[model samples]
Target: MASSCIGKTWCSSARVGLSLSSCVASVAGKRNRFAALLQREQGGRKVSVSSSVRSQSDPIGGIQEGLVCKPSVVTGVPSELARSRRRAGRTSQYRFIMAQAASADGAAGVDSSATFPTVGFLGLGIMGEAMARNLVKAGYDVTVWNRTASKCASLATEGAKVGLLPRDVTEACDITFAMLADPTGALSVACGEHGAVKGLGPGKGYVDISTVDGVTAMKINEAVKATGGEFLEAPVSGSKKPAEDGTLIFMTAGDKALYERASPALDVMGKARFFLGEVGKGAAMKLVVNMVMGSMMASFSEGLALGDKIGLDANTLLEVISLGAINTPMYTLKGPAMVKGQYTPAFPLKHQQKDLRLALALGEEVVQPLPVAAAANEVYKLARAAGLGDADFSAVLETVKSHSRGSTSNDH
Candidate 1:
């Protein structure tokens, strides 16, 4: 096993049919493949050095930058031994190799094992910033980039490096995580002239944790795959509070191998994870859950409105509902908020509306009818129509109330 390093990031490349333990060893020592090669030149040939090149274990014949070398042979080497091999002076081969090592992390090639790879986080909004903080707190070397550079100020003090552009992020980190507003926002930073895709290659991984539709996710997946980077769709449930608390549930889908590689990071950002098969499953699951939530909120609205007209105290009604078989955490969380008229955005109306819209499209694709979900979608549409798109989705009750007063049509 051989471990290589590019800058501070560790990259491991392993040859086929070799034990992974061996690859883990090659890249584990302080003296990386390049450093070992340099030492051999100064040791006057008694070192009997193995292949000085980074291993090409990838089936595609080459490894990418920031990936540790997975050596064909796996043997433990002591760090003290690596540190003691300092030979200074006149080997042209040593100079040539140092030049190669200097630019290895910058190019799309195999990496060294001496350092931890940097992680680049894009979007520092409510969710993005929290996710980045968790990564930093978990001990990942992190770099951040946000459209509003001011958004990154808080994280910079937490030992996070801030960069100016998405391309800079790619150049700095081995893996990049994106938590943007939607597909448009994700694509804006991921594709085009100065986007991340330009810097992505075989050694890079891009995880999109945004809530885009399955189709949009597929398009993004295609874009990332075309650039030789691994892509994963990891839409999440819960909102800003869950994100901050690190309890967001990830509905992930993509290459299972890549998912395994990222499980450590995902575990840091979320409490639970569900690998739902392909690229679209995570998006599909998010849409399904949101559709149910939207519809349930709509139903709860009607129930509460009727209870109101019948002279029931909304608070007591909520207490009763909370005790009954109909109780749900969603009810508990939103009931008091609704009762107090505190409809601040946790999950904004526009995003919920987007989820419903995507669910409706998915339903159409599968030829499945979702009348209740359809009805809920209509309520959200009405909420948006009422200029409440930026409010919490619970504000849909306003539309329900207005409709109850015979102010509008519910016809589809």
Candidate 2:
């Protein structure tokens, strides 16, 4: 298996609000009706902030009445960008976010002294919705936004108020978490012309929990820093089940101070969290892990096909693999399904291919030879061409099996 890094990018400048007015910084500007919370405490007062600020002394203004936010504003990004982020395997806590911000204003600053962290959720899809549900279930005050209006329905049933736009989500909560589908979508929501970037100021923090390459993460980091909002790239490993179980593992990289402030929320969503350093490392590490996974799946597919060529019992082959030194939890979980021809997608084929593509891209940058991964990438391509893009990645076995002379005969 070969490990690799992915693409290039130009950088630029990209919160959640708090429940308590004390947890929030209030400011009044003649031209701008706006406020920003300090990233840290100063004399026990929430730091006040401003946008489009070049120096430390810039002042924030007020909100304009009747500003219309696009549907994407509430869902973490615009609908088109959000759709792009959602390829196949990746799921987001987008749904929960939807319900929270379904109403114009979230439950009026839930009794500050006893209020839990008010969360501003950007992106309200499958995983995003589930995670938000858990937070609501845990009694956390959550505000949500999504690209589409319809997605907010489930969450609204849970007593969540939907936001009119993305900025509203930030204004309604203390801290905001972004569970977008990809870097573009995450960035779109955070830095678009009327995106979250425009809404953030100091004292607010943005956590990006999407699986994009390092370059994208760095771009986001720069944007957040420019606006005085702290940024962290905290991508996760493990698929939908792990997210639902709250046992996902976080690969985080950012300022240590921001990490401390975000840890409690991260802890609620994931079982393990690693502070990888800087902004891009977490994304970098995730690519490496997926590279190995792509290679492993390809190798297993070859092995299973070869075994069948010699008349080996499918059950026996799986059992033997499970007991061998090469045994891995991934194989154990997917192998039986491969043998049984059940490829109901836990992780989709197209997404597996995307990860492999990302891994190979990284390999090119690092000058690492990955003949195995390269070959696997081809196989994944074939799987995609065969119209199995939406199928489970375990379906990789089908390609090998169907192509082999003996296995094809057995299929009939």
Candidate 3:
């Protein structure tokens, strides 16, 4: 592997067949120079290095900043290394190369092994557990904690160290990520007694990937920064399956340097990431996305109910919709299950309602009229009232069907 530091960003190129461990061993003596390159001074203070470079597209304009590890030209290698590459697969080799390069730069305080940053994850709920697992799978030294300690058992079995409290996780790790269910939970984990913030200091960073209001996110940012720790609010855009599959989209804001540092882990857990600038933008963007999704789900439920009432097969309606301009993965994935009255909770109805409530409040704060979203919020409330709170958000169809029944009976 060959590497260079450019403007606080480290770029590395690896020969196609070279093993990452062998490459790291080859450059073991150059650790001091690599460390010096990162410690370059600007004025009297040390310059903060970004682990990634800005893409040709602007991140401030909402495009994803390109991550580090630009691909290097592949060269022919010895037969043994070529066989190794073929055995390990190119994707794994490249990922290993990038991981090693990032570690060797020491921008994120990787250990002497030059392997991975110590990662702490708090809140192992449905989404959180899956995300933490992905990081562990990607070879990070991960510590996990959850409110219900039993939730940590599965991860412990998977080689993640379990923490007794949020502070313990933060104190022991270089970077801590929280994915609580709400702003309240987020605050409680980060700012409550013995919270994550209590363990933070210089060289430690906290990233909250929880769904929260801008105000709440800003509050967490303040608490984290007060501890001399960096903060990033990175609320994701996909639900349980995406979280499990590591294909979620991250809408991130606050602490650009930390974002760059967290890039490798983020890449492990998400397919795309957008740095939207400032502390609350990510929360706002996530709320807006969820608001749109809630409204769409409500409308789709009504459409299905209306079709069934008019003697059209719900499946047929779904098929027609799938073939149309408005087709989306949500509809394609949820429609058939919804038609069968099987809502298995990929994204729970209660959380959808919560996001809708938060989005409506955001609109109210900005004095923007969201009449459609208001209607959808009411529909979700009805679903929750019908004891479908724990069901998939697609269970909103039952409320739509219930409303249809009331209308039909009123005609009698």
Candidate 4:
């Protein structure tokens, strides 16, 4: 496999905070907030931080467990373009992370820390509510905020404090997480007047789980950091089921220190995680993954349509695919529904289209060709044009049939 560099090299081992505050030397008579962490040369290969940042087996920043081992923040980034992202797959300590508060009988994994920090959640949509509920059920003190006050009510009944504003939630908690529907909402809540950042100060952290472009993530990161708060771009990689079941995968980046502090909360919300170095990598990874998924869903729709055109039962075709190596959870969950012309939203079609669009833009930025993503983008656009934006992304099946055999089967 090809090796990538995160701008450093390690021979034995090392870590440092490197106080950016002092490193802010004036350039052209102006101080710079961007700081570079010192590096030691090791054959000049540039450091490839392990795919998983293996935490040292020591308590980190007053938190117990394997949170101590963390990567030094990648430095030398310009003030205008500073960002980082990271997360990890299954690791030993994470097993403890995913566990719920132990039963009253003193079962295993009981969190007895009086210093466990309270968490604040902004946005209460489909994904947000479930994630916040999982945190609350895991015994972390949780406060929640939503534009629609009624949405917060449901979580309030489940032992979460209903906060009056994003500011209210952030002020009252050590870390605040935002899971808004889109970049606009996420930006508004985090950077707006009386928004979450207004309440954020030193020692506080903000994790944004919303799917947004790298530009938006960095904008929020700068805004948060300007106020002495930390930022982590931790966009998730699952739908409603994964969110509710506490099995979502988190693609986290930025603020390795905050990553250490938030490990327990992250473990509660995700089954697996990867700490991609730097802020935009997490968002980049999600877009790349979703681009493939969107294309696959579009191709799957084509397969179903071709089967129906050739006089095969849609269910039979779906069963055959399931038994084949090409099968996946997307096919298993959306196949039958597509065959029956059901498009109830598991993940909204518009969101899938949005992800594809973002992926294409990222490709353009890096000069990567994304021919397949471009084609898939068109199919999703067709579904949106057919008024299936709010339907499951699998609704592209209907759009596929219309394009393939001129069957106007999307009238539902």
Candidate 5:
């Protein structure tokens, strides 16, 4: 055998054919190629270092930071030395590099050693973090990237690789999922410099789960297709808790092949997923769902306010509604919270307003009359203007209460 090792592999030392590297050391008659690179936890996002020059932590898990790995050439090393190095643990400056692999964790997750399509996640907000972690727990090799790198540190510990740009994730993985804040952010990350479009090519998939308008989704889809990459717009229906529990509802469209290929991953992150046949359809479905949701919340708030003014208890009103024909999970889940004056934002008021605004505009463009949705949009806007934009959508109760007070003062 040739003496030189190639990144932890024994190889011909002649520096020809396929084995040339800057990392090798030998003891006695043995040579091993050592690699020192940071592997992040499952929900992490980007970290690019120049020769790891900016790496703040040591290679070992024990030290929080300050681990520097500089490669040095070594000649003549025995196999026993390699065995000793393995036993030395993470504290050793030089660790043996093994082939990239992942192990399957039954049907739910994958281990880091088994060979599967590497997954990439962009944006590590609450929803993104939760979704990415589910994939990690299912045993898939995931690479993550976020605008705020600090949010990704914990995921790095769970065996995720950090990426520096939207394109980095696209180039590195067969499929990439993005869960950004809004349509603007989604478009920027997908089409801007170092965006997903730059890295996407044939055989790659880009799945965006952001709640954007159909026009926005279609635009992104066109950009991805221009790069010969598949695109799927998969906007979800449930909120934070559902995302965390892997019970979200996925409304997906565009690129049937990509949809089929992403089924395993989608199954891991959602309870049910619908393939709606086209990119804009999925976006439209999400908007319609939210539009109905906003109208229902606005109506619910009005009912509660009216019941209160009639000296009926809010809880009693909720109980009556819960048993009525129109009762829904939204009423069941948010009723008590609304009654108790607690709005912790399962869905923000501002987002609801935005969705309603979009749905109304969509209705207008299609020449469909949506007086109820239009009215609900105004209430949500009123709530947003009342400084409840960050609060839960149900906080529109305050908007209702303010209106009621104004009505009473006018009556006096």
Candidate 6:
């Protein structure tokens, strides 16, 4: 029998001379061995093999169906395999079946390759652009779109296909991810006219990685599910540098199956992911996290301002804080530049303020008091009023310093 592995599971045979039934019996007997080998090769990941092998003999075509070998879905199989696939210039799903078959029966045959799913990205802002670029670099077939249109040009030059509209990109890809700036942009791109929902149906998934309220996320989820498509709210926890470095932490919810389907892509874009259950949960978790962050930034700014006002060098204060128990990466990263009055936006002041506002509203809805976050929101508002809204959130230090100077003037 002349046989070849097809897809990820089955084997197809062209009748020639060997005993096909005997071969199937032998392979079936050694199914446990195959499973063990696969598990060992895959770093202890569970591998389940199907027991029954059904075959149909085609008398007219002289072709016989070979033994069936189906394995459970395996993921996180190390990046080395992916890198090898890329280096080999193969765009299909690589399986270990061919090698195993060759070793089992010494029947060397061609194995068919399965192509990777096409991915689509909407919005090309700082976060989205970096994320989409990483996907393209990872050998994914990526299509991108942006409202500005020009923003898509840079990614396009990096081998990403440009989409004319959100709908166009969704229609062309199996899974689509959106990283819009705020709730309004996220909703508009996902549910508005010429939006992603318009092009979605069964077998398509939409992952919203934008920061939004739970209500907005639920609305988007409803719209996506209404189209027989899958939705996952995957707001991230990181700023510009993390996005650029592909180390953003994903807080995901809604559509468990979609989460599984989108894991490989998410793995490419984020360092870690937490599947939080249902659509609103992810959004709520992100809001709470941002609320705490906003408050912390406010406190850090106040500390820096107080140290400067009390005859202390700001950098020296930073070093002292670094050695203390209260030290954090946020302070370590933004303290020096902030002390020198340089605040290039990594996470924009306006966006951080927006997140704080949304978080306060969420707290109100749940009848929970968030006084510290509310106070932080006021500081962010003051900074925004002082025209620091487009700067980094760390620029709130300037607002703190300005207030301290005003108090000193009044005291004099």
What overall lDDT goes with each candidate model? 0.68, 0.62, 0.75, 0.70, 0.70, 0.74
Q: Per-residue alpha-carbon lDDT of model 4 for 187-270, expressed as tens digits?
A: 999989879999999878999999999999999999999999999999989898888877788999999888867766776677
- Candidate 3: where is the Cα deviation over 4 Å? 6-95, 98-114, 409-412
Model 5 scores what on Cα lDDT? Answer: 0.70
Residue 360 C-alpha lDDT in model 6: 96
Rank all candidate structures by their TM-score, best first, as comma-separated numbers: 3, 6, 4, 5, 1, 2
Candidates in order, TM-scores: namely: 0.71, 0.69, 0.78, 0.74, 0.72, 0.76
lDDT of 5 by residue, 114-218 (tens): 224678999998789989987776546789999999988989998788998989988888889999988999999999988988999987889999999999999
Q: Give the clash total for candidate 6.
A: 1
Candidate 3 has which clashing residue pairs, if any? none
Q: Candidate 2: where is the Cα deviation over 4 Å?
A: 1-110, 113-115, 405-412
Q: How far is each candidate from the true structure, as Cα RMSD in Å?
A: 13.1, 15.2, 10.4, 14.7, 14.9, 10.9
Pick by lDDT: 2 or 4, better one: 4
Which lDDT tens digits does candidate 2 get at residues 59-172?
A: 111011121121111121101112212321111222111122222122343222221346777787657777776665444567778899778788888867787677787666
Q: How close is candidate 2 to the true structure, as a TM-score?
A: 0.69
Deviation from native of the Cα of residue 78 in model 4, angstroms: 41
1-412, model 3: which lDDT tens digit per residue? 1122122234333222244334444456444432332232112233222233211222112112242222211111111112212322333234444444554545435432323568899998889999999877655679999999999999999889999999999999888999998889999999999899999997788999999999999999999989888999999999889888878899999998788677657766877788999999999999999999999999999999989888998878989999999999999999989989999878889999999999999999999999999999999998899999999999999999998888855585
Q: Provide backbone clash counts, one per model.
A: 32, 56, 0, 21, 36, 1
Show where candidate 1 strays beyond 4 Å: 1-116, 406-412
